[model samples]
Target: MRIAFIADPLPSFKIHKDSTYAMMVEAAKRGHDLYFML
Candidate 1:
């Protein structure tokens, strides 16, 4: 499946305890297509 994450700039993201980033990472690990729109 394809997933698009339209969020704040990934560079500026404070990933500590970030569920959204965690979810995206999990999806990527599962081989889903990932798109980021800053």
Candidate 2:
């Protein structure tokens, strides 16, 4: 599956605190392709 996330700059994410980042991590674990857009 392919997942796209429209989010802030990647470096700005706090992995422990950012929900979107967490979701991205989970998606990646499940083998989905992730794309980010500003």
Candidate 3:
């Protein structure tokens, strides 16, 4: 399956540990194609 995420930019520090990043990471691990949009 493929998944995409669209979100406004997070604060710089927040990106490192943000939930969105985690979700993307997990999705990639599970073999889902991911895309990001502002």
Clashes of each: 0, 0, 0
User: Tell me, what's the RMSD of every candidate?
Assistant: 0.9, 0.6, 2.4
Q: Which stretches of candidate 2 lie over 4 Å from their true place?
A: none
Model 2 worst lDDT window (10 residues): 8-17
Q: On residues 1-38, what C-alpha lDDT tens digit does candidate 3 reach at each position?
A: 87878876645427676888888889999999988777
TM-score of each: 0.82, 0.91, 0.70
Q: Which pairs of residues have clashing backbones in candidate 2?
A: none
In model 1, the runs with Cα more than 4 Å from the true position are: none
lDDT of each: 0.89, 0.95, 0.79
lDDT for position 20 in model 1: 77
The deviation in Å at residue 8 for candidate 1 is: 0.4
Cα lDDT tens digits, model 1, 1-38, are: 99999888888777997777998999999999999887
Candidate 1, after superposition: displacement of residue 34 in Å? 0.3
Give the Å shift of residue 30 in candidate 3: 0.5
User: For model 1, what is the error of residue 32's alpha carbon versus the real structure, in angstroms, after optimal superposition?
Assistant: 0.3
Assess the local accuracy of residue 8 in candidate 3 as a C-alpha lDDT between 0 and 100. Answer: 64
Q: Which stretches of candidate 3 lie over 4 Å from their true place?
A: 9-13
